[model samples]
Target: MPSPFRHTTPPEPASAAGPVRAVYTQLARDFGITRAPTFVVLSSVPEIMASAWALMRESLIAGDGGRTGKELAALGVSEANRCPFCVDAHKMLLHATGDHALAERVARGEQPADEDQARVLAWGRATRIPGAPELTPYPFPAAHAPAYIGTALAFHFINRVVSALLTERLLPGNVQRFRAVRSLGGRSLSRTVRRHPAPGAGLTLLDGAGLALLDHAGPGPDWARATTVGPAYAALRAAAGEGERLLDADDRILVRETLGAWDGAHPPLAWDGLPGRDRPGARLALLAALAPYRITEEDVAAWRTPDRTDAALVRLVAYGAFAAVDRIESALPVRTAKEAS
Candidate 1:
């Protein structure tokens, strides 16, 4: 049967020599690197890889929890892409995030050092395979499946973006390596060859554990420090309590303003900050409060330009804050005994 993936045959070395040599020549001409080889024979994965870096950096600015989430997702994608460069980069990022053991496992492609890492890696691998079902046998809770699917889709989107850039040889450093990997000549295989009994069952359990970690860690210090804006959170809570939907422009403006203030004052939050922070609970609270507003790539892009200020940063903060709100509401049971009482 024909493959569903966009498989590109590796050009013959002689055929590749022209383009490979041309890329080096262009790099030399463009960058004026006369002495060293203009194009290092790295794989054609850098543009997407660079984008991943930018995305992660932006996510970090958005909030600590957001950074952690994006790091895991990036690791999953790197592993799926089978790009050693990305794998190495994510390992460093994970290490920086304080997950050394799991980072090592992901780098080596061995069984994850722990269940959390395994779930992420498995999810990443699954995203790379065509026609894989959204639901897996992994131990993830049924209720959390949508979130897992969201994670998977996020990775898928990143993978597609990276693959497009790499396949097109847009990244000079990766051109040679991409050509080499393609030339090594493996079948364009997908991971869905056989169904493992109880495959993905581990994910349900893993996701639960991840959620537990998030809960325990709270929004984390980064958010806690920024969201010292107590009045804003109070207003947000009151609005939410009154069922004043976020669609109202006034509500959005309030959320946007509060978050903007938070972002401006606080340092960019990172994954590593979570375990060492004093008030994970407060941080989590702030994040939980902010998770609900709809965010898009455009919103993220707005924060990326070099000239952004504290107020702009606050927009990102607001995005994270609302996101936190969404997460809290989604994860916790709504009809509690207190409410019923």
Candidate 2:
């Protein structure tokens, strides 16, 4: 007998043209299905994202060098979030970017080959297991430290935003969208936020970046907050870009002091005498306190561990904390005349 999954008649196109119609058209074209695509109708958010994809593309490019870093970051975050859709999407993106080996490893939940890839993968794993705060550090040779730290920090922010987007179900073409295109580096979570309606309508709440979004539901609040962390993130990025030359005796002191504070606040959630809702805030405060020392990639590189699992998780948290600090620092105004100009 013929297979039960044999080709079936296609669905009729919608009489009225809309976002769904457009998606249907695109899906049909992509999948080579003459019939309409089976995806559920999406809201205006996806359409908005499609229209403003360029801006989002620019944001990701500006944040990282290109799709490779962005994809690595996305994969790390997806792994952290435990979102199957995101994992699939990021894996596809990685493959498309000629990172076939890394893509295969990520699919198997195995560690990446290089420190940068490994660090990102670790970040993703850590995001899943929140109880093990000690798992945030990376395990790599000292020479690879700065790159690992910078990449880890970048991936942390990427993971936060992507997780929020996935949580909100704002991804284009629904959950399977990432499978078709692979690379989300061309997209921005900011655009996703601007395009979609806030989950709770007008409820304002704190996000990872310490900013508030009007619609504070799902991942919206988190991404909204992350947007506000731009300044601190930029500062860290600047320092990382400058490489080892940026470090000094004062920088070392700052790093040590900040690391000490982080050690004290390592498991901010585990601290006794804290309210339930206040845990995340407390963690954020602890992270903010470490901002001063996280000025360079070298500072971040110093946070690695030897054990694979523990190293991965620790690196993830460290990355998030570092990104938060970078965004905060970047927002500050430059007092010097040259900077102001």
Candidate 3:
């Protein structure tokens, strides 16, 4: 099965040097996968990769809520984002958590039998809707909120990346559909996906240089604050690129201005209303922001007659995802502000 990764190929773990090699080894060992595809693709920018892994580890992978609840939240986010790839992946993980019936219910688009589980899923979906005020009265206790929030935020970024960069099927062929195969795959990963204490701040990768980015998110679950940084870094790094940007100066200005006025909700902008240039690249950026899942080969055809390069397309997608994330994060009331004072 040939990989669908075209814009940027996952780097060989053995060939990776220094920090990149360490990140690959740690993620592989801890994640219980031969290769963590998302990490590998993000490794195109090493700093982004390391910080993303750390935030995910601190929040979702190593947190308090059981695997069932966490995976449920992940599935909800994936479903809302319309990313079939992540939806399938989380369903497999949910099955691995020994809730076969529950997993099937979610995959079937039905509510879980467990009320708490159902609430978690509902919250996840709610977060995907931008500018959704009154996100208050969380379904879980204060202590458990971080894990769920972290998991949702992590997958929010992930779903966008996977939709843009990778193929839908978890495996190359139809193997992902076989219950036995998904179950076995989940069991294999069970050992490696243990929880860890939330590592609060002071990560060397983020140092003083990038610390300010965390402020935009305005505090909450420890995991949310940290996870917000990953997308921020991605957006900034892509913006800083010296190459020919897909969104030129005027297009960039339009996106920023339009996004500034956005109501912070999904299905917000109409297709034609989205800011775009006459060129294919700018039009693609508008499509990415308004309806990423709708992007198809025809949309890609508009930009590149031959084939899409990894750098610009990936960066543009990241920027669009972050723009949405930032809008939501900014709209929500600050959880950590009162505590800080």
Candidate 4:
């Protein structure tokens, strides 16, 4: 099959080695998909790919939160970000959860009939807002907050990555658009969705191996402290930090300041304060952080050159997305249960 990647060459899953291979292996065994484009796009940075997979696998796939609820949260985030690809993928995953009615309802842009799911969906979407009051009383159980919170945060990053790096179609020929295809695709992975993966199974790809080499990998945010989510979060943070080298120090500061002042509302069509063509990388970064869907072909074209490779674009966008994630994480209330001792 042709790779879903547009701007860069995706790693050959067949010949991938070490941590990259481990991530592919786990995705097949645990995520039930052999070639996940969202992840393969990061294979240029094996540690980042492994770290990102760990966060998603631990929280969305194996963590303690309800699977259907996590899917709702993920879908909510995708909706908020306007990532059509992720939105489609999540609706299919929702079908995998066997809530076809709910999936169809959400796909139709309708609120779920169930009050709890409605709240969960709302909470997931609302997470994009920094310090929004709705965030205070989390919709899921406090004890299960790590999984729920991790799932939301993970998608916050993943959605940005997808919108900026990948094309809009989740599958070839846009096959996922058909209701039957969506259900069938979801059904294909129902076993993986229902099976309980060993908690922290993704760590096998990150730990003790040279994969954990990021210097700034800290214990993660207070909201995600005391769980497997922390290390995974930290590794991703450190990995994304690699983008700092792509832009001038001043451009990085500009992107951070822009994201810090953001209100989670989409910017006006004009998107003021963005740099001009002279600073295409920064422009792309800021867009990735706050309004990835707004990014255009010209925008990417402006930054990409013979000198800048696909891996660099991925890093630059990851940096921008994580800047926004940092802002979101900073404002996140401690709604989850206190860290385990």
Most accurate candidate by TM-score? 4
Per-residue lDDT of candidate 4, residues 143-189 (tens digit): 78888888988999999988878889998988999999999999999
lDDT measured at residue 130 in model 4 versus the true structure, 0 to 100: 82
Show model 4 residue runs off by greater than 4 Å: 1-3, 214-216, 339-341
lDDT of each: 0.33, 0.35, 0.62, 0.85
Write down the TM-score for model 4: 0.94
The candidate 1 region of ten consecutive residues with least summed lDDT is: 186-195
Tens digits of lDDT, candidate 3, 1-341? 68856445666666877556666666766566646777676666555565566556655666556767878888888888888888888888887777778877776779998898888788777776654542555666555565566667667777777776777777878587777777777777666654343443313334333433344423333334344434433323333232225567877776667667766345554555653334666555545554676566666666664445654566666666656655555554436422322
Instruction: Pick the winner on lDDT between candidates 1 and 4.
Output: 4
Per-residue lDDT over 1-341 for candidate 2, one digit per residue giving the tens place of the 0 to 100 score: 22111012122354424433554443343322322111221112222112112112223332223445555655665454344544665666566556556666666667777876666455434432333442334333332222223343444443332332223233443443443344343232223212222221111111221222212222211222333223323333332222222234444344435434432222333544322232332232233233212122333234323442322322333334444434422332212211211
- Clash count per candidate: 37, 19, 6, 0
Query: TM-scores of the models, in the given order?
Result: 0.30, 0.33, 0.78, 0.94
Model 2 Cα shift for residue 143 (angstroms): 19
Tens digit per residue, CA lDDT, model 1, 91-189: 554544544565555555576655755665565555444334421443243333333333333333333223321232322444323323322211111
State the number of backbone clashes in model 2.
Answer: 19
Q: Arrange candidates by lDDT, descending.
A: 4, 3, 2, 1
